[model samples]
Target: MSEHLTIVEHPLVQHKLTLMREKSTSTASFRQLLREISLLLGYEALKDLPLTEIAIDTPLTEMRAPVLAGKKLALISILRAGNGLLDGILELAPAARVGFVGLYRDEATLKPVQYYCKVPADLADRPVLVVDPMLATGNSSAAAVDLLKERGAHDIRFLCLLAAPEGVERMRQAHPDVRIVTAALDEKLNDKGYIVPGLGDAGDRMFGTK
Candidate 1:
Protein backbone atom coordinates (compact mmCIF):
# COMPACT_ATOMS: atom_id res chain seq x y z
CA MET A 1 0.00 0.00 0.00
CA SER A 2 1.27 3.50 -0.75
CA GLU A 3 2.15 5.45 2.37
CA HIS A 4 -0.18 8.28 1.38
CA LEU A 5 -2.70 8.19 4.18
CA THR A 6 -2.41 11.10 6.59
CA ILE A 7 -4.95 12.01 9.29
CA VAL A 8 -4.91 15.72 10.05
CA GLU A 9 -5.39 16.44 13.75
CA HIS A 10 -5.19 20.17 13.93
CA PRO A 11 -7.17 21.72 16.78
CA LEU A 12 -9.29 23.82 14.45
CA VAL A 13 -10.10 20.84 12.27
CA GLN A 14 -10.93 18.69 15.26
CA HIS A 15 -13.11 21.37 16.76
CA LYS A 16 -15.10 21.93 13.63
CA LEU A 17 -15.34 18.23 13.11
CA THR A 18 -16.99 17.91 16.51
CA LEU A 19 -19.55 20.55 15.67
CA MET A 20 -20.27 18.84 12.40
CA ARG A 21 -20.92 15.58 14.18
CA GLU A 22 -23.53 17.03 16.45
CA LYS A 23 -27.05 16.00 15.47
CA SER A 24 -28.27 19.53 16.05
CA THR A 25 -25.84 21.33 13.77
CA SER A 26 -27.77 23.12 11.05
CA THR A 27 -27.19 22.38 7.40
CA ALA A 28 -25.71 25.81 6.82
CA SER A 29 -23.18 25.35 9.60
CA PHE A 30 -22.47 21.84 8.45
CA ARG A 31 -21.71 23.03 4.94
CA GLN A 32 -19.51 25.85 6.19
CA LEU A 33 -17.65 23.58 8.56
CA LEU A 34 -17.11 21.11 5.73
CA ARG A 35 -15.52 23.77 3.59
CA GLU A 36 -13.26 24.87 6.44
CA ILE A 37 -12.25 21.32 7.21
CA SER A 38 -11.62 20.64 3.53
CA LEU A 39 -9.07 23.44 3.35
CA LEU A 40 -7.22 22.08 6.36
CA LEU A 41 -7.38 18.54 5.02
CA GLY A 42 -6.33 19.67 1.56
CA TYR A 43 -3.33 21.39 3.09
CA GLU A 44 -2.21 18.12 4.64
CA ALA A 45 -2.89 16.12 1.45
CA LEU A 46 -0.86 18.47 -0.80
CA LYS A 47 2.12 18.87 1.51
CA ASP A 48 4.36 16.79 -0.74
CA LEU A 49 3.46 18.28 -4.10
CA PRO A 50 6.64 18.51 -6.11
CA LEU A 51 8.41 21.84 -6.12
CA THR A 52 11.07 23.19 -8.47
CA GLU A 53 13.46 26.07 -8.08
CA ILE A 54 13.05 29.08 -10.34
CA ALA A 55 15.14 32.22 -10.71
CA ILE A 56 13.26 35.15 -9.27
CA ASP A 57 13.91 38.60 -7.80
CA THR A 58 13.08 39.56 -4.23
CA PRO A 59 12.55 43.11 -3.06
CA LEU A 60 16.31 43.71 -2.81
CA THR A 61 18.05 40.86 -4.66
CA GLU A 62 17.65 38.15 -7.23
CA MET A 63 17.35 34.60 -5.89
CA ARG A 64 16.16 31.15 -6.77
CA ALA A 65 12.58 30.47 -5.62
CA PRO A 66 10.64 27.28 -5.37
CA VAL A 67 7.41 26.78 -7.31
CA LEU A 68 5.03 23.90 -7.92
CA ALA A 69 6.60 21.39 -10.29
CA GLY A 70 5.14 19.92 -13.48
CA LYS A 71 1.60 20.47 -14.73
CA LYS A 72 -1.28 21.82 -12.65
CA LEU A 73 -3.22 19.67 -10.21
CA ALA A 74 -6.58 18.08 -11.03
CA LEU A 75 -9.29 17.87 -8.38
CA ILE A 76 -12.03 15.36 -9.16
CA SER A 77 -15.10 15.35 -6.95
CA ILE A 78 -16.96 12.08 -6.47
CA LEU A 79 -20.32 13.78 -6.42
CA ARG A 80 -22.53 14.80 -4.92
CA ALA A 81 -21.28 14.74 -1.36
CA GLY A 82 -17.76 15.03 -2.65
CA ASN A 83 -18.68 18.48 -3.82
CA GLY A 84 -18.63 19.56 -0.18
CA LEU A 85 -14.91 18.87 0.09
CA LEU A 86 -14.31 20.00 -3.46
CA ASP A 87 -15.30 23.58 -2.75
CA GLY A 88 -12.61 24.23 -0.17
CA ILE A 89 -9.91 22.36 -2.04
CA LEU A 90 -10.65 24.53 -5.03
CA GLU A 91 -10.25 27.58 -2.87
CA LEU A 92 -6.81 26.36 -1.90
CA ALA A 93 -5.83 25.17 -5.38
CA PRO A 94 -7.84 27.52 -7.53
CA ALA A 95 -5.81 26.78 -10.62
CA ALA A 96 -6.21 23.04 -10.36
CA ARG A 97 -8.31 21.45 -13.10
CA VAL A 98 -11.67 20.17 -11.83
CA GLY A 99 -13.61 17.04 -12.74
CA PHE A 100 -16.65 15.14 -11.50
CA VAL A 101 -17.57 11.51 -11.04
CA GLY A 102 -21.17 10.91 -10.08
CA LEU A 103 -22.10 7.48 -8.78
CA TYR A 104 -25.28 6.44 -7.07
CA ARG A 105 -25.75 3.55 -4.70
CA ASP A 106 -27.72 0.64 -6.09
CA GLU A 107 -30.32 -0.39 -3.54
CA ALA A 108 -30.41 -4.08 -4.46
CA THR A 109 -26.73 -4.73 -5.00
CA LEU A 110 -25.60 -2.14 -2.48
CA LYS A 111 -22.88 -1.11 -4.91
CA PRO A 112 -22.12 2.14 -6.64
CA VAL A 113 -23.35 2.57 -10.18
CA GLN A 114 -21.86 5.31 -12.25
CA TYR A 115 -24.43 7.78 -13.51
CA TYR A 116 -22.09 10.41 -14.88
CA CYS A 117 -18.36 10.90 -15.21
CA LYS A 118 -16.45 13.70 -16.87
CA VAL A 119 -12.74 13.93 -16.21
CA PRO A 120 -10.00 15.92 -17.82
CA ALA A 121 -8.23 14.47 -20.82
CA ASP A 122 -4.97 12.54 -20.39
CA LEU A 123 -5.52 11.62 -16.72
CA ALA A 124 -2.21 9.77 -16.77
CA ASP A 125 -0.42 13.05 -17.24
CA ARG A 126 -1.97 14.91 -14.30
CA PRO A 127 -1.86 14.46 -10.56
CA VAL A 128 -5.50 13.73 -9.69
CA LEU A 129 -7.01 14.16 -6.24
CA VAL A 130 -10.44 12.58 -5.71
CA VAL A 131 -12.58 14.01 -2.94
CA ASP A 132 -15.56 12.61 -1.09
CA PRO A 133 -17.04 13.20 2.36
CA MET A 134 -17.71 9.69 3.60
CA LEU A 135 -15.80 6.61 2.62
CA ALA A 136 -18.42 4.23 3.93
CA THR A 137 -18.26 0.95 2.04
CA GLY A 138 -15.56 2.23 -0.35
CA ASN A 139 -17.50 0.65 -3.20
CA SER A 140 -18.19 3.96 -4.91
CA SER A 141 -14.71 5.26 -4.25
CA ALA A 142 -13.13 2.10 -5.61
CA ALA A 143 -15.38 2.11 -8.65
CA ALA A 144 -14.55 5.74 -9.29
CA VAL A 145 -10.84 4.96 -9.12
CA ASP A 146 -11.34 2.04 -11.46
CA LEU A 147 -12.94 4.33 -13.99
CA LEU A 148 -10.10 6.80 -13.63
CA LYS A 149 -7.58 4.04 -14.08
CA GLU A 150 -9.42 2.89 -17.18
CA ARG A 151 -8.93 6.44 -18.43
CA GLY A 152 -5.21 6.29 -17.58
CA ALA A 153 -4.99 8.02 -14.20
CA HIS A 154 -1.73 6.62 -12.89
CA ASP A 155 -1.19 8.97 -9.96
CA ILE A 156 -4.37 9.40 -7.96
CA ARG A 157 -5.29 10.01 -4.32
CA PHE A 158 -8.54 9.63 -2.39
CA LEU A 159 -9.47 12.29 0.15
CA CYS A 160 -12.39 12.16 2.54
CA LEU A 161 -13.75 13.75 5.72
CA LEU A 162 -14.39 10.46 7.49
CA ALA A 163 -13.78 6.77 6.89
CA ALA A 164 -14.83 3.49 8.40
CA PRO A 165 -12.32 0.73 9.02
CA GLU A 166 -14.19 -1.61 6.72
CA GLY A 167 -14.14 0.97 3.99
CA VAL A 168 -10.42 1.53 4.42
CA GLU A 169 -9.77 -2.19 4.31
CA ARG A 170 -11.94 -2.54 1.23
CA MET A 171 -10.03 0.22 -0.56
CA ARG A 172 -6.72 -1.29 0.52
CA GLN A 173 -7.74 -4.62 -0.88
CA ALA A 174 -9.18 -3.22 -4.07
CA HIS A 175 -6.62 -0.57 -4.86
CA PRO A 176 -3.55 -0.75 -2.68
CA ASP A 177 -1.81 1.73 -4.92
CA VAL A 178 -4.31 4.54 -4.30
CA ARG A 179 -3.48 6.57 -1.24
CA ILE A 180 -6.32 7.55 1.10
CA VAL A 181 -6.29 10.77 3.09
CA THR A 182 -9.03 11.34 5.63
CA ALA A 183 -9.80 13.45 8.67
CA ALA A 184 -10.89 10.67 11.01
CA LEU A 185 -10.86 6.89 10.99
CA ASP A 186 -14.05 5.92 12.70
CA GLU A 187 -14.81 2.49 14.11
CA LYS A 188 -16.28 -0.33 12.04
CA LEU A 189 -19.39 0.32 10.06
CA ASN A 190 -22.82 -0.62 11.34
CA ASP A 191 -24.94 -3.45 9.93
CA LYS A 192 -26.53 -0.89 7.67
CA GLY A 193 -23.17 0.00 6.20
CA TYR A 194 -23.05 3.40 7.81
CA ILE A 195 -19.96 4.54 9.67
CA VAL A 196 -20.50 4.44 13.41
CA PRO A 197 -20.94 7.86 14.96
CA GLY A 198 -20.87 9.17 11.41
CA LEU A 199 -22.51 12.48 10.64
CA GLY A 200 -25.14 10.47 8.74
CA ASP A 201 -25.90 10.51 5.00
CA ALA A 202 -23.47 13.18 3.85
CA GLY A 203 -25.49 14.20 0.81
CA ASP A 204 -28.67 14.45 2.81
CA ARG A 205 -27.00 16.39 5.59
CA MET A 206 -25.19 18.71 3.25
CA PHE A 207 -28.34 19.47 1.34
CA GLY A 208 -30.76 19.65 4.31
CA THR A 209 -32.92 16.87 2.93
CA LYS A 210 -34.22 13.69 4.54
Candidate 2:
Protein backbone atom coordinates (compact mmCIF):
# COMPACT_ATOMS: atom_id res chain seq x y z
CA MET A 1 0.00 0.00 0.00
CA SER A 2 1.09 3.56 -0.62
CA GLU A 3 -0.02 7.16 -0.15
CA HIS A 4 -1.06 8.10 -3.66
CA LEU A 5 -4.45 9.68 -3.27
CA THR A 6 -5.63 13.30 -3.61
CA ILE A 7 -8.94 14.72 -2.38
CA VAL A 8 -10.03 17.81 -4.32
CA GLU A 9 -11.77 20.41 -2.16
CA HIS A 10 -12.54 23.20 -4.58
CA PRO A 11 -15.66 25.16 -3.66
CA LEU A 12 -17.15 24.75 -7.11
CA VAL A 13 -16.52 20.99 -7.04
CA GLN A 14 -18.04 20.64 -3.60
CA HIS A 15 -21.04 22.78 -4.45
CA LYS A 16 -21.85 20.82 -7.57
CA LEU A 17 -21.27 17.53 -5.76
CA THR A 18 -23.71 18.58 -3.06
CA LEU A 19 -26.30 19.25 -5.71
CA MET A 20 -25.66 15.88 -7.30
CA ARG A 21 -26.02 14.09 -3.96
CA GLU A 22 -29.53 15.34 -3.31
CA LYS A 23 -32.11 12.61 -3.89
CA SER A 24 -34.50 15.08 -5.49
CA THR A 25 -32.06 16.28 -8.13
CA SER A 26 -33.20 15.55 -11.68
CA THR A 27 -31.19 13.57 -14.19
CA ALA A 28 -30.48 16.62 -16.35
CA SER A 29 -29.20 18.60 -13.36
CA PHE A 30 -27.11 15.68 -12.18
CA ARG A 31 -25.52 15.22 -15.58
CA GLN A 32 -24.82 18.93 -15.92
CA LEU A 33 -23.37 19.15 -12.44
CA LEU A 34 -21.22 16.07 -13.11
CA ARG A 35 -19.83 17.72 -16.23
CA GLU A 36 -18.99 20.87 -14.30
CA ILE A 37 -17.38 18.92 -11.47
CA SER A 38 -15.36 16.72 -13.82
CA LEU A 39 -13.84 19.81 -15.41
CA LEU A 40 -12.62 20.97 -12.02
CA LEU A 41 -11.40 17.52 -11.01
CA GLY A 42 -9.63 17.08 -14.34
CA TYR A 43 -7.85 20.34 -13.82
CA GLU A 44 -6.66 19.20 -10.40
CA ALA A 45 -5.74 15.71 -11.64
CA LEU A 46 -3.53 17.21 -14.34
CA LYS A 47 -1.86 19.79 -12.11
CA ASP A 48 1.33 17.78 -11.74
CA LEU A 49 1.67 16.70 -15.37
CA PRO A 50 5.25 16.65 -16.55
CA LEU A 51 6.20 19.87 -18.29
CA THR A 52 9.03 20.94 -20.57
CA GLU A 53 10.22 24.34 -21.69
CA ILE A 54 9.91 24.94 -25.39
CA ALA A 55 11.20 27.81 -27.49
CA ILE A 56 8.50 29.60 -29.38
CA ASP A 57 7.97 32.95 -31.05
CA THR A 58 5.16 34.88 -29.39
CA PRO A 59 3.28 37.81 -30.86
CA LEU A 60 5.29 40.11 -28.63
CA THR A 61 8.66 38.33 -28.76
CA GLU A 62 10.37 34.96 -29.05
CA MET A 63 10.66 33.17 -25.73
CA ARG A 64 10.58 29.80 -24.00
CA ALA A 65 7.28 28.56 -22.60
CA PRO A 66 6.32 25.55 -20.52
CA VAL A 67 4.23 22.90 -22.24
CA LEU A 68 3.13 19.36 -21.53
CA ALA A 69 6.22 17.15 -21.86
CA GLY A 70 5.15 13.82 -23.34
CA LYS A 71 2.79 12.72 -26.07
CA LYS A 72 -0.93 13.54 -25.87
CA LEU A 73 -2.51 12.12 -22.72
CA ALA A 74 -4.55 8.92 -22.86
CA LEU A 75 -7.93 8.98 -21.09
CA ILE A 76 -9.41 5.57 -20.27
CA SER A 77 -13.07 5.47 -19.34
CA ILE A 78 -14.27 2.53 -17.21
CA LEU A 79 -17.46 1.70 -18.95
CA ARG A 80 -20.87 3.43 -18.56
CA ALA A 81 -20.31 5.77 -15.63
CA GLY A 82 -16.83 6.70 -16.71
CA ASN A 83 -18.36 8.08 -19.88
CA GLY A 84 -19.85 10.97 -17.92
CA LEU A 85 -16.43 11.93 -16.60
CA LEU A 86 -14.83 11.27 -19.98
CA ASP A 87 -17.12 13.65 -21.84
CA GLY A 88 -16.50 16.47 -19.37
CA ILE A 89 -12.74 15.98 -19.34
CA LEU A 90 -12.70 15.89 -23.13
CA GLU A 91 -14.23 19.34 -23.14
CA LEU A 92 -11.06 20.53 -21.45
CA ALA A 93 -8.49 18.23 -23.10
CA PRO A 94 -9.89 17.88 -26.57
CA ALA A 95 -6.60 16.67 -28.01
CA ALA A 96 -6.23 13.80 -25.53
CA ARG A 97 -6.59 10.25 -26.83
CA VAL A 98 -9.59 8.30 -25.52
CA GLY A 99 -10.20 4.63 -24.70
CA PHE A 100 -12.85 2.49 -23.03
CA VAL A 101 -13.09 -0.56 -20.77
CA GLY A 102 -16.51 -2.10 -20.22
CA LEU A 103 -16.61 -3.97 -16.94
CA TYR A 104 -19.95 -5.08 -15.62
CA ARG A 105 -20.35 -6.13 -12.00
CA ASP A 106 -21.36 -9.72 -11.53
CA GLU A 107 -23.88 -9.82 -8.70
CA ALA A 108 -22.86 -13.22 -7.36
CA THR A 109 -19.14 -12.52 -7.36
CA LEU A 110 -19.22 -8.79 -6.79
CA LYS A 111 -16.32 -8.54 -9.20
CA PRO A 112 -15.83 -6.80 -12.50
CA VAL A 113 -16.37 -8.78 -15.70
CA GLN A 114 -14.82 -7.14 -18.69
CA TYR A 115 -17.07 -7.27 -21.73
CA TYR A 116 -15.29 -4.66 -23.83
CA CYS A 117 -11.90 -3.01 -24.04
CA LYS A 118 -10.01 -0.98 -26.61
CA VAL A 119 -7.09 1.34 -26.07
CA PRO A 120 -4.50 3.19 -28.06
CA ALA A 121 -1.49 1.13 -29.14
CA ASP A 122 0.86 3.72 -27.62
CA LEU A 123 -0.52 3.44 -24.08
CA ALA A 124 2.93 2.65 -22.71
CA ASP A 125 4.32 5.82 -24.26
CA ARG A 126 2.00 8.46 -22.81
CA PRO A 127 0.57 9.20 -19.41
CA VAL A 128 -2.69 7.31 -18.81
CA LEU A 129 -5.57 8.74 -16.80
CA VAL A 130 -8.34 6.25 -15.94
CA VAL A 131 -11.76 7.73 -15.15
CA ASP A 132 -14.59 6.17 -13.16
CA PRO A 133 -17.34 8.03 -11.33
CA MET A 134 -17.56 5.84 -8.24
CA LEU A 135 -15.03 3.48 -6.66
CA ALA A 136 -17.00 1.14 -4.42
CA THR A 137 -15.32 -2.25 -3.90
CA GLY A 138 -12.42 -1.34 -6.25
CA ASN A 139 -12.40 -4.77 -7.84
CA SER A 140 -13.40 -3.36 -11.21
CA SER A 141 -11.03 -0.42 -10.98
CA ALA A 142 -8.22 -2.72 -9.96
CA ALA A 143 -9.08 -5.21 -12.64
CA ALA A 144 -9.19 -2.47 -15.25
CA VAL A 145 -5.85 -1.15 -14.10
CA ASP A 146 -4.40 -4.65 -14.20
CA LEU A 147 -5.43 -4.96 -17.82
CA LEU A 148 -3.70 -1.71 -18.60
CA LYS A 149 -0.57 -2.77 -16.81
CA GLU A 150 -0.56 -5.99 -18.74
CA ARG A 151 -0.59 -3.89 -21.88
CA GLY A 152 2.61 -2.09 -20.79
CA ALA A 153 1.14 1.01 -19.11
CA HIS A 154 3.35 2.16 -16.28
CA ASP A 155 2.64 5.81 -15.64
CA ILE A 156 -1.02 5.77 -14.68
CA ARG A 157 -3.52 7.65 -12.52
CA PHE A 158 -7.06 6.89 -11.40
CA LEU A 159 -9.68 9.64 -11.21
CA CYS A 160 -13.14 9.32 -9.70
CA LEU A 161 -15.95 11.46 -8.33
CA LEU A 162 -16.35 9.57 -5.04
CA ALA A 163 -14.51 6.76 -3.25
CA ALA A 164 -15.03 4.62 -0.18
CA PRO A 165 -12.23 3.97 2.27
CA GLU A 166 -12.35 0.24 1.63
CA GLY A 167 -12.11 0.78 -2.11
CA VAL A 168 -9.19 3.16 -1.66
CA GLU A 169 -7.43 0.64 0.51
CA ARG A 170 -8.07 -2.09 -2.00
CA MET A 171 -6.44 -0.03 -4.73
CA ARG A 172 -3.54 0.87 -2.46
CA GLN A 173 -2.79 -2.80 -1.87
CA ALA A 174 -3.35 -3.81 -5.47
CA HIS A 175 -1.43 -1.05 -7.24
CA PRO A 176 0.72 1.32 -5.26
CA ASP A 177 2.20 3.15 -8.18
CA VAL A 178 -1.10 4.52 -9.54
CA ARG A 179 -2.20 7.75 -7.91
CA ILE A 180 -5.88 8.22 -7.13
CA VAL A 181 -7.66 11.58 -7.38
CA THR A 182 -11.20 11.97 -6.11
CA ALA A 183 -13.63 14.73 -5.32
CA ALA A 184 -14.84 13.17 -2.05
CA LEU A 185 -14.06 10.15 0.13
CA ASP A 186 -17.27 8.83 1.59
CA GLU A 187 -17.74 6.89 4.83
CA LYS A 188 -18.20 3.34 3.57
CA LEU A 189 -19.93 0.98 1.21
CA ASN A 190 -23.47 -0.16 1.81
CA ASP A 191 -24.69 -3.77 2.00
CA LYS A 192 -24.93 -4.00 -1.75
CA GLY A 193 -21.49 -2.45 -2.24
CA TYR A 194 -22.47 1.11 -3.06
CA ILE A 195 -20.69 4.03 -1.45
CA VAL A 196 -22.53 5.29 1.60
CA PRO A 197 -24.04 8.73 1.01
CA GLY A 198 -23.05 8.34 -2.61
CA LEU A 199 -25.15 9.79 -5.42
CA GLY A 200 -26.80 6.40 -5.89
CA ASP A 201 -25.80 4.42 -8.98
CA ALA A 202 -23.85 6.97 -10.99
CA GLY A 203 -24.64 5.32 -14.30
CA ASP A 204 -28.32 5.19 -13.52
CA ARG A 205 -28.51 8.73 -12.20
CA MET A 206 -26.56 10.23 -15.08
CA PHE A 207 -28.48 8.46 -17.84
CA GLY A 208 -31.98 8.45 -16.25
CA THR A 209 -32.00 4.67 -16.38
CA LYS A 210 -32.84 4.29 -12.68
Candidate 3:
Protein backbone atom coordinates (compact mmCIF):
# COMPACT_ATOMS: atom_id res chain seq x y z
CA MET A 1 0.00 0.00 0.00
CA SER A 2 1.06 3.56 -0.48
CA GLU A 3 2.66 5.07 2.64
CA HIS A 4 0.15 7.86 2.05
CA LEU A 5 -2.92 6.00 3.25
CA THR A 6 -4.16 7.22 6.65
CA ILE A 7 -5.37 4.70 9.25
CA VAL A 8 -7.22 5.28 12.51
CA GLU A 9 -5.09 3.58 15.16
CA HIS A 10 -6.58 4.76 18.42
CA PRO A 11 -5.83 2.67 21.51
CA LEU A 12 -9.46 1.78 22.09
CA VAL A 13 -9.76 0.68 18.46
CA GLN A 14 -6.65 -1.45 18.86
CA HIS A 15 -7.85 -3.09 22.06
CA LYS A 16 -11.18 -4.05 20.56
CA LEU A 17 -9.46 -5.21 17.40
CA THR A 18 -7.35 -7.69 19.39
CA LEU A 19 -10.40 -9.37 20.84
CA MET A 20 -11.95 -9.68 17.40
CA ARG A 21 -8.79 -11.34 16.14
CA GLU A 22 -8.87 -14.10 18.75
CA LYS A 23 -9.61 -17.55 17.29
CA SER A 24 -11.84 -18.67 20.15
CA THR A 25 -14.25 -15.80 19.54
CA SER A 26 -17.61 -17.29 18.50
CA THR A 27 -19.59 -16.13 15.47
CA ALA A 28 -22.09 -14.40 17.71
CA SER A 29 -19.34 -12.73 19.69
CA PHE A 30 -17.53 -11.82 16.52
CA ARG A 31 -20.64 -10.22 15.07
CA GLN A 32 -21.15 -8.22 18.24
CA LEU A 33 -17.57 -7.05 18.26
CA LEU A 34 -17.80 -6.06 14.61
CA ARG A 35 -20.82 -3.89 15.35
CA GLU A 36 -19.13 -2.24 18.33
CA ILE A 37 -15.87 -1.60 16.52
CA SER A 38 -17.66 -0.36 13.41
CA LEU A 39 -19.51 2.23 15.45
CA LEU A 40 -16.26 3.40 17.01
CA LEU A 41 -14.65 3.63 13.63
CA GLY A 42 -17.67 5.41 12.20
CA TYR A 43 -17.35 7.94 15.02
CA GLU A 44 -13.91 8.88 13.76
CA ALA A 45 -14.92 8.58 10.11
CA LEU A 46 -17.71 11.13 10.53
CA LYS A 47 -15.89 13.64 12.76
CA ASP A 48 -15.87 16.16 9.96
CA LEU A 49 -19.59 15.95 9.20
CA PRO A 50 -21.00 19.40 8.75
CA LEU A 51 -23.14 20.57 11.64
CA THR A 52 -25.49 23.56 11.85
CA GLU A 53 -26.47 25.34 15.00
CA ILE A 54 -30.09 25.17 16.12
CA ALA A 55 -31.98 26.45 19.14
CA ILE A 56 -33.00 23.64 21.48
CA ASP A 57 -34.09 23.17 25.06
CA THR A 58 -31.44 22.06 27.59
CA PRO A 59 -33.90 21.20 30.39
CA LEU A 60 -33.30 24.49 32.17
CA THR A 61 -33.16 26.84 29.17
CA GLU A 62 -33.08 27.00 25.40
CA MET A 63 -29.60 26.57 24.01
CA ARG A 64 -28.05 26.20 20.61
CA ALA A 65 -27.55 22.62 19.45
CA PRO A 66 -25.49 21.25 16.62
CA VAL A 67 -27.35 19.13 14.12
CA LEU A 68 -26.16 17.60 10.89
CA ALA A 69 -26.28 20.24 8.18
CA GLY A 70 -26.93 20.41 4.43
CA LYS A 71 -28.10 17.40 2.46
CA LYS A 72 -28.60 14.11 4.30
CA LEU A 73 -25.97 11.37 3.99
CA ALA A 74 -26.22 8.18 1.97
CA LEU A 75 -24.88 4.95 3.50
CA ILE A 76 -24.10 2.23 0.95
CA SER A 77 -23.42 -1.22 2.31
CA ILE A 78 -21.26 -3.42 0.04
CA LEU A 79 -23.51 -6.38 0.53
CA ARG A 80 -23.60 -9.35 2.96
CA ALA A 81 -20.75 -8.61 5.38
CA GLY A 82 -21.11 -4.90 4.97
CA ASN A 83 -24.56 -5.26 6.48
CA GLY A 84 -22.96 -5.93 9.88
CA LEU A 85 -21.23 -2.55 9.92
CA LEU A 86 -24.20 -0.90 8.21
CA ASP A 87 -26.51 -1.61 11.13
CA GLY A 88 -24.36 0.27 13.64
CA ILE A 89 -23.86 3.27 11.36
CA LEU A 90 -27.62 3.38 10.83
CA GLU A 91 -28.06 3.60 14.59
CA LEU A 92 -25.75 6.61 14.61
CA ALA A 93 -27.20 8.25 11.49
CA PRO A 94 -30.75 7.05 11.41
CA ALA A 95 -31.96 9.69 9.00
CA ALA A 96 -29.23 8.88 6.55
CA ARG A 97 -30.38 7.25 3.31
CA VAL A 98 -29.35 3.68 2.55
CA GLY A 99 -28.07 1.87 -0.54
CA PHE A 100 -26.76 -1.57 -1.45
CA VAL A 101 -24.31 -3.01 -3.96
CA GLY A 102 -24.19 -6.77 -4.31
CA LEU A 103 -21.08 -8.17 -5.99
CA TYR A 104 -20.76 -11.89 -6.48
CA ARG A 105 -17.42 -13.24 -7.59
CA ASP A 106 -17.32 -15.06 -10.91
CA GLU A 107 -15.83 -18.51 -10.54
CA ALA A 108 -13.98 -18.42 -13.86
CA THR A 109 -12.73 -14.83 -13.86
CA LEU A 110 -12.35 -14.69 -10.10
CA LYS A 111 -13.65 -11.14 -10.37
CA PRO A 112 -16.62 -9.47 -8.78
CA VAL A 113 -19.70 -9.02 -10.92
CA GLN A 114 -22.56 -6.85 -9.80
CA TYR A 115 -25.60 -8.87 -8.95
CA TYR A 116 -27.63 -5.95 -7.69
CA CYS A 117 -27.40 -2.19 -7.02
CA LYS A 118 -29.92 0.18 -5.51
CA VAL A 119 -29.12 3.69 -4.26
CA PRO A 120 -31.00 6.51 -2.60
CA ALA A 121 -32.11 9.86 -3.95
CA ASP A 122 -29.86 12.81 -4.90
CA LEU A 123 -26.61 10.94 -5.27
CA ALA A 124 -25.15 13.95 -7.04
CA ASP A 125 -25.51 16.09 -3.92
CA ARG A 126 -25.26 13.92 -0.81
CA PRO A 127 -22.03 12.73 0.74
CA VAL A 128 -22.03 8.95 0.36
CA LEU A 129 -20.27 6.57 2.73
CA VAL A 130 -19.62 2.99 1.55
CA VAL A 131 -19.13 0.36 4.25
CA ASP A 132 -17.59 -3.11 4.02
CA PRO A 133 -15.75 -5.37 6.45
CA MET A 134 -12.66 -6.43 4.53
CA LEU A 135 -10.89 -4.91 1.51
CA ALA A 136 -8.40 -7.47 0.29
CA THR A 137 -7.54 -7.22 -3.44
CA GLY A 138 -9.41 -3.92 -4.00
CA ASN A 139 -11.00 -5.19 -7.22
CA SER A 140 -14.45 -5.55 -5.67
CA SER A 141 -14.31 -2.37 -3.60
CA ALA A 142 -12.95 -0.32 -6.48
CA ALA A 143 -15.55 -1.76 -8.79
CA ALA A 144 -18.22 -0.88 -6.26
CA VAL A 145 -17.00 2.71 -6.19
CA ASP A 146 -16.97 2.87 -9.94
CA LEU A 147 -20.60 1.86 -10.00
CA LEU A 148 -21.43 4.54 -7.46
CA LYS A 149 -19.64 7.20 -9.47
CA GLU A 150 -21.42 6.14 -12.61
CA ARG A 151 -24.66 6.76 -10.76
CA GLY A 152 -23.57 10.38 -10.03
CA ALA A 153 -22.05 10.06 -6.57
CA HIS A 154 -19.11 12.43 -6.89
CA ASP A 155 -18.26 12.74 -3.21
CA ILE A 156 -17.49 9.34 -1.74
CA ARG A 157 -15.73 7.75 1.21
CA PHE A 158 -14.95 4.12 2.08
CA LEU A 159 -15.18 2.68 5.59
CA CYS A 160 -13.87 -0.76 6.42
CA LEU A 161 -13.06 -2.86 9.49
CA LEU A 162 -9.76 -4.03 8.04
CA ALA A 163 -7.74 -3.71 4.82
CA ALA A 164 -4.84 -5.47 3.20
CA PRO A 165 -1.89 -3.43 2.01
CA GLU A 166 -2.40 -4.56 -1.54
CA GLY A 167 -5.98 -3.39 -1.49
CA VAL A 168 -5.01 -0.04 -0.01
CA GLU A 169 -2.41 0.50 -2.68
CA ARG A 170 -4.81 -0.41 -5.46
CA MET A 171 -7.49 1.89 -4.10
CA ARG A 172 -5.06 4.78 -3.85
CA GLN A 173 -3.92 4.29 -7.43
CA ALA A 174 -7.47 3.77 -8.70
CA HIS A 175 -9.12 6.63 -6.82
CA PRO A 176 -6.82 8.93 -4.95
CA ASP A 177 -9.45 11.58 -4.27
CA VAL A 178 -11.75 9.25 -2.33
CA ARG A 179 -10.57 8.85 1.27
CA ILE A 180 -10.33 5.30 2.68
CA VAL A 181 -10.92 5.05 6.40
CA THR A 182 -9.84 1.72 7.82
CA ALA A 183 -9.04 0.44 11.31
CA ALA A 184 -5.88 -1.39 10.28
CA LEU A 185 -3.99 -2.25 7.07
CA ASP A 186 -2.60 -5.72 7.50
CA GLU A 187 0.58 -7.18 5.97
CA LYS A 188 -0.48 -9.08 2.84
CA LEU A 189 -2.90 -11.43 1.16
CA ASN A 190 -2.23 -15.15 1.22
CA ASP A 191 -2.32 -17.47 -1.81
CA LYS A 192 -6.04 -18.19 -1.57
CA GLY A 193 -6.64 -14.40 -1.62
CA TYR A 194 -7.24 -14.10 2.13
CA ILE A 195 -5.60 -11.38 4.11
CA VAL A 196 -2.63 -12.63 6.09
CA PRO A 197 -3.32 -12.45 9.80
CA GLY A 198 -6.80 -11.32 8.98
CA LEU A 199 -9.70 -12.34 11.22
CA GLY A 200 -10.55 -15.15 8.79
CA ASP A 201 -13.60 -14.78 6.53
CA ALA A 202 -15.48 -11.81 7.90
CA GLY A 203 -18.81 -12.95 6.46
CA ASP A 204 -18.46 -16.40 7.97
CA ARG A 205 -17.39 -15.06 11.33
CA MET A 206 -20.23 -12.58 11.47
CA PHE A 207 -22.81 -15.10 10.28
CA GLY A 208 -21.61 -18.06 12.40
CA THR A 209 -20.46 -20.50 9.72
CA LYS A 210 -17.46 -22.00 7.87
Give the number of the best model, judged by lDDT. Answer: 2
lDDT of candidate model 2 versus the reference: 0.92
* Tens digit per residue, CA lDDT, model 1, 54-148: 99989999999999988889899998999999999999999999999999988677699888999988888888899999999999999999999
Pitting candidate 1 against candidate 2, the one with the higher TM-score is: 2
Q: What lDDT is reached at residue 23 by model 3?
A: 88
Whichever of 1 and 3 has more TM-score, that candidate is 1
lDDT of 3 by residue, 96-146 (tens): 999999996665665889899999978988888999989998888999999
Candidates in descending lDDT order: 2, 1, 3
Q: Write the per-residue lDDT of candidate 2 for residues 1-210, one digit (tens) a residue.
A: 236889998888889999999999999999999998999999988887899999999899999999889889999999999999998999988999999999999988798999999987788898999999999999999999999998889999999999999999999999989899998999999889999999899999999995
Cα-based lDDT at residue 143, candidate 3: 94
In order, the Cα lDDT scores of the candidates are: 0.89, 0.92, 0.87
Q: lDDT score, residue 173, model 3?
A: 87
Q: Give the per-residue Cα lDDT of candidate 1 at 1.
A: 23
Off by over 4 Å in 3: 1-4, 57-64
Indicate the TM-score of model 2: 0.97
TM-score, every prediction: 0.96, 0.97, 0.92
